[model samples]
Target: MATPLWLAGCVAAPKPSVQATLPPAPPPTLAPVEVEPAAPATQPASLFTLITQGPVSAMLSYSEKVRSLNGNELNAELARLGEPGDVPTAQMQTALALAQTRVPADLARAVGLLQRVAANTSAEARPLHPLARMLAARYLEQRRIEDDRDRQVAQLRDAQRRIDQLNDRIEALRAIERSFARPANGAAAAPASNGAKPAP
Candidate 1:
């Protein structure tokens, strides 16, 4: 009887409580990425500014050399630049022309050179330089004015010729009228001579 009681107590021992396991923590939070903004684009310099202040040609470096050059040196360089068959002749000419205009005395020469450059270009293809364009416009305007003057002169000549023809026609008509009048007068005199008189 004592052994049964002890066995019963051993079998009835309370089952241990089952504790639920917690899930693992999520991955560590990442700091937000700090992306830099893109840089803005820069604008290219103007053709006028480049020609006047910078080198017009890669073959000849005018920017730095021009700064150091005196008036004489600049003049000599301009003479060299003006020669025919120079490499990149158009650009060199433009640069030299721009430089020449800096001197008060040489401004006229610069305008002349610019005029030449402008004349060479057509409406379909124009120079990038502002001075070059202005020069071309001046050339075209001068030509247009000359053409208008010539046209007016031709018109005047034609009008004078027409007036002369009209005057000749009027004189011819007057002569015909005078001739007819004489015939009528002769007929009237002949009627009178034939003794046919108008009854009053």
Candidate 2:
């Protein structure tokens, strides 16, 4: 039997579609940006070290007082120590010496004590606390400069005295020469040793 045109189209197989199902796309990868690190900050000079020392029994009492004492209290403590001229214990020396610097009147004495402490301290041992040898060195340098200046002033004074003496001697010699050149006491002029008369 012959089929109709519409029926033949319906029976024909459908053509395959060009579009295809695809898997989901993954996230894009990004390159990481590099940054330079900042430089470390510089520390200012200070007498105290940041390192904490283990508690020393000898320094325990004084160290506590130094940390908490006011100006008046510090003065009193120093006065008490001054009565017998008691030497400070080694453990408390640095802290006590540093505390002394706070008193204007005690500045020189404090620096001297620090110098002695620095001298006695062994560098290989634990570092000095609350006091640096640099402070002692600076004080000594100032003293040396002052001494040198005093010597220079003395030398300059001596030089000035010698110059004045030489000037006075020169003046005296000039006066003597002038007097010798002039006829004295209205004396008559000396006759010429030669008998020959001077020609006009």
Q: Candidate 2 on 77-148: residue-level lDDT in tens? A: 665555322233442344354444444435556566655555554552234433436545665565567678
Candidate 1 per-residue lDDT, tens place, 7-48, comes to 998897688999999999999999999995433223222333
Score every model by TM-score: 0.35, 0.38
Residue 17, model 1: lDDT of: 100
What's the lDDT for residue 83 in model 1?
52
Best by TM-score: 2
Q: For candidate 1, what's the RMSD?
A: 17.1
In model 1, state the lDDT of residue 90.
48
